[model samples]
Target chain A: MTTIDSPPPPTLRADSLQAIGVEDMGVRYDLRFTKKTTIRRSVGQILGRGSQEPFWALRHVSLRVVHGESLAVIGPNGAGKSTLLQVLAGIIRPSEGAVDVRGHVSGLLTLGAGFDRELSGRDNILLGGAFLGLEDEVTRRLLPSIIEYAELGDFIDAPIKTYSSGMRARLGFAIATSVDPDILLLDEVLATGDANFRAKSKARVIEIVRAAKAVVLVTHDMSWVTEYSNRAVLIEKGRLIMEGDPAEVVALHRQHTDEARAASAAAATAAGLDPGIAGQGRR
Target chain B: MSVTSEVPAAFRNAADDPGAARLIREGLADIVSRRRLVRYLVQADMRKRGADTILGNFWWVLDPLLQMLVYVIFVTIVVSRKTPDYPLFIFAAILPWKWFTTSVVDATSAVASQDRLIKQIQFPKLVLPVATTTAGVVGFAFGLIPLAGLMLFYADRISPFLLLVPLIAVVQYVFTLAFSILLAAGNVFFRDLGNVARHVLRLWWFLSPGLYSLAVLDEVHVVQANPILKVIANANPFAILFEAYRKVIYGAPTSPPGLPDWTSLAVLLLVSVGFLALSTVVFKRLEPSFAKVL
Candidate 1:
């Protein structure tokens, strides 16, 4: 038997890159306000100089996805997982760092970003496909499959505003996955859809990943991470705290949460906020 | 390069290269693609809005007709007396001026309003202003059909110079695009641009002869010190185009009863092009920040 080297040669699911590469990237978002003298910012200005300051959404976060690699970004709320995905999708700009992506990226942060509420589901699918950078010819070819996959049935001709939020998610997912983007960024998208549709969507996503060049799955679902990801990264605050086998990293994260909680409590107290504030916040 | 490095002179120098060729090729392609999406979005929006009113699409015609009637009453009854066949003159000038002013105002807020979309998409930011302006142009076109019918009844004479309507429309559209881009880009950082635009447009209207005939101001010193305003009043594409409409419809001189100075038209075109080039550079340089601020 030939000796296998280089960490099992990174499973190749496509003819092209079996992995996607991301260099040392940093993203800084300048949340520029129109200088409105709000009570909050006004107080800050009175207390300190430089009335405005930029919020760093992502700071020097970098990871690589092998063509056919599945990576899960597991983090607490506001840990910048979605921001990393947005940077990868090129939707959000990085003020300081650079991101060099190898293939097309389809992001699933909001299911309805491309859907016009006024348009019919059919029209919206075509529009969504076009918005995702699909050519008219490509959309025309994929129309039937996209509609069928959405499971929208006769409702495809009905106005999308009439569709439930779940239905919209299904439609958006179908349209996005139809193109087989080289790299996929899924941000808590699996949480949407009914049980029956959820299973189907998961199967479809699996099918996509089976053929996809790379995928970065950002979700709070630990089970999904364990089941789907070959590699897992846990980000705390703005930095990566752990990375390795999904199960081992998650176990380590669970063990370290007590320490993390203590630090957060101390920091919260220092900042004059309740220690239990974020915990009491929305899930 | 590390973020801590000093501002390198070489890199800073590259910022002033004008970047016209790269912008024309890459920027235009990106803009054209985004414009396609904008077209679809506008179509969907129009359908939704058109279906909301009780009269369905007829409101497009009625809205302008009603406005023309108001302007007619205001101009003939309240303001200018020299507007011969005042109703027809007002109707002729109303549609184009409405097109220019509304389009500019609408385009000023176009990008600012779509802050969510701009922040989430990497396509050219110019698409929003251009799309808003296009929507205004389309609305103006819809309003023109009824105006043409009014012209047939009130002002029956016709002239060949009427062909300038489309050419002048192009000039106005290009000029609006340049202004909209500048204003829209500026508004991204300065929230007061919208307010400034309203007053500026009001001032521009007074200077453009949209409500008054240029013949009334032949000897005014304001016309001498500000020839562009004077030319804007007389050969102002909006005024000149409507004057062309008046000539085609009422056998009147197309432009203040004098030969239009080709130099002014050339100058307007040059100024518009200059503003456009300037706005493109500024917009591109600022684009990296749009997704964050917007």
Candidate 2:
């Protein structure tokens, strides 16, 4: 057989008392190999072994979710919304702090994360199932319902690349929700697909959200934050800024955005720049 | 029913660098527990490689046969070497060499290429290299059909020592696996590694006994006079492995098919297992950063 890090060690463990727990968690990313600066700094390093700057994608964030709870995380772009979900999903181990998660976690963290575009939906389903460490037979038993939910019909046999973006999202949602794990983590996915598909999926999401012991959703849609979650937390600049009723959290996030825009607009006006353009800049 | 990490902050970060014992336990445990993922990934890999092609699986059979012929013509006509049953002799080295090169090359990018998958899901990153390397075994298995045909065609070269093929392969597997883990993790931190690996592997093939066995190397004064070069030549695992393949497949120009060098095989096994443990430690140490870097 072939053979196959880190310390604070981000500590994410499982405890029976809580569905998920994070204590002083943080994830630092190296700027050199990051998507934006990767090319420039990588070349710089090759030319003259330069020191790499580390960006704290998340910092001093602690959160907890208990069984029978649904928590929504909302934030603007690059606010580490997905990063928080990634930590909860155990895809990322924090550089600092500890986390405990109680049971099996299944998620469609990113719409296209686990899919192989060249494989048929059938193959990708099995592939995704295998990613969750399920055997072929166990995945096969769940196939019919996944297909029905995805509504791929004959397209289930076609390569995933040929499926519309909506179909892809549907298939992803189906797989994540199908396994009935104790906890479900979803990332910016509920807003996908056509209206009819969305309507049908809302019911499925509700069913899953209610059935699973705990559910964590990351989305930009304010409506979804309130409509889907009983408890919500707002994230901004990698910090948990607020946590409360979903509607109140969503409202506060909106107020903060508007205030940020107004402040930027005022600064623009004082500097003889266009307020409209400046308002858009911060977002 | 409630609990909190009682570990002090200083000690909490201790997990950042696991002890050797824990690293070994986790490394072995991850590979063992998630074997189904490896099998599935290997199947998916083979399916993708052969998809939508007219010849499909036939290419696996045809590829080595065609390469053997090319090498045979190059050796006999271009180099003017006269060797009988050259096809079987060369074919033996070709199969295992191909497996080693292809698996290692694949492992170099295995984890790096799954950047999105790694970031979005949680599982042992160990599975990535394990899966890619095991897929090579399947590809190598496909190459065996040609090996069988060559043996049957040259019935005179057949020997009971051929049963030792799997035994020899086991050694090669252990060695390739150790290197694959190292390469897989190293390539993530240094993107240039994959590019360098291709050229290095090609040079390695040339330096190994693929084209000429140790029997020939012993005849060279440059290699014989320099004890360091002589030891390096013997230390090349492929030197021992390729020579073993040749021994069981047909043997040197003067000798008949026979058992491989067991002493060498055993040494390779122990060294490879040690290297595998070391590679696993390195791989795991770098793993948490993979989702970050990639």
Candidate 3:
């Protein structure tokens, strides 16, 4: 597996990355339970207190990415990986800190994120391009290339609802990369589609990283981390646990997962339940 | 790739401390830059709304025509018809009223309905409400074709002032757009507002001079005696617009006083512009909370 050494300082990194940066960003969400009666809640809120509880989705996380850098974020579910990506994409507002993105940002948090299912693929391309802030004429000019890259052919005119899952992924990936944004945020988008499409998408992503300013990828695929990303960060329970070389971070994550599994198994055995049965229930 | 050393203004402004004026300025700038997105969204909505039906876009014109037919039948059988050219009279008011009611109602839920798009994409939040209003205008424009046919049948009633119809339509559009932006932004926080607006709009329709002309009210001595009621009756933007359409289309003289009251038109314009400015400020203030609430 390919591994990168420690990254250079921010000034030196800026020379390679262009001008992308993230500084001390944090996001918080209030967990509201509407169990109280409306009148009672209103009265309480008016009195300067309410039942809503607050929790941080991401807390005091800081990272600097420059041009040509692909930073991989790996964590277990609910580790705030997706939240961080959403915050970077400007979809979510941070509660405690600031994020400064230098240029145009394209995000693929989910397949066909803003696509209208009733619209044909051709129309969706126009709509999606517009959402990315591309003018209509520019989208028109990019149409042939998007279709060619997606490999949808005759299906491009069909409504998106009729397309297979893989086809939707291909179309989304094609349109997102077509714009060549200065900053790209991907949340497991590279893991979609069949092997052939995956290879093509990977190649396209490589081109984007080489050509564009910066990229932040959130994925559990360790192979992708080692091979593609120059830096990796492991976060757990909304806290940044470690950051450095991809291989080092992956090794730390594996050790942490094993320890957690062993501790859970021991707790189950102590309670007179088979660990295997506990694992089966989870599966 | 060569990169600029200076941070872009977008990044230099701290997210936490962006003042209200700054937010409004940035939001407006963002919307202006993404104006093509608004147009595309409007077109996509206009097409997708009725694509599955046999009538398709025919419904845009058909829906208002059917409403006008119901009012015509009611006026002919039940109500006292003081106005000549009754069908043309109802057409003038109903066409613009349909635009106002539908645009306001559709826009009320525009933000909440696009939960996925708002949560995933980073485009201006104002686009959703603005696009919905524009889509309503497209339907209203189609509804005008039949009105034009009715206008031709009453060719003698047409006036030189008919050139003012487009100006009146622009005023009404601004009025509808302001209400739409206000309601769309409010409904994000209070989902019940959408349901409330439907019933409220039904009452509002009757309050306007849509079904019956102001001439009927002018004949009532009781309506004229109450100064408060008279002022309210005149102050309504819908009444002002419908009256403007009647004056321009039917060459009808202004009621209560025969002379044209340009003050009403000026008042309507002022209210529409002032309301638009107010709603934009409110929308920008509420925008950052939308994703979390949704």
| Maximum-lDDT candidate | 2
DockQ of each: 0.18, 0.25, 0.37
lDDT-wise, the better of 1 and 3 is: 3
Residue B155, model 2, lDDT: 84
**Per-candidate local distance difference test:** 0.67, 0.81, 0.78
The sequence of per-residue lDDT tens digits that candidate 3 reaches over residues B148-192 is: 778788877766676677788888888888899999988876677
Winner on DockQ (1 vs 3): 3
- Tens digits of per-residue lDDT, candidate 1, A136-233, equal 67788889998898888999999998998888888888876776666678888787788988888788777776666667889878887888787889
The residue-by-residue lDDT of candidate 2 on A1-283, one tens digit each, is 1000111111343344467878888888876665423344577876868766778888888887777678889987899988888777777777888777767777767665689888899989888887876656778988999999888899999999898888888898888777766778888776778999888877777777777778899888887777767788999999889988888899999999898888877777755666566556554
Q: Residue A165 lDDT in model 3?
A: 85
In candidate 3, how many Å is residue B213 off? 2.1
Model 2 scores a C-alpha lDDT of 0.81
Q: How does chain A of every candidate compare to the true chain A by TM-score?
A: 0.80, 0.83, 0.85
Docking class of 3: acceptable
2 or 3: which has the higher DockQ?
3
lDDT of 2 at A62: 82
Per-residue lDDT tens digits of candidate 3, residues A229-269?
A: 88999999899999998999999999999988887777677
Best by DockQ: 3
Compose the digit string of candidate 1's lDDT tens values, residues B68-187.
Answer: 788877766776565556666666667777777877887777777766555444456777777777887788778878877776775444345455566556766777788787777777
Better of 2 and 3 by lDDT: 2
Recovered native contacts, candidate 2: 0.33
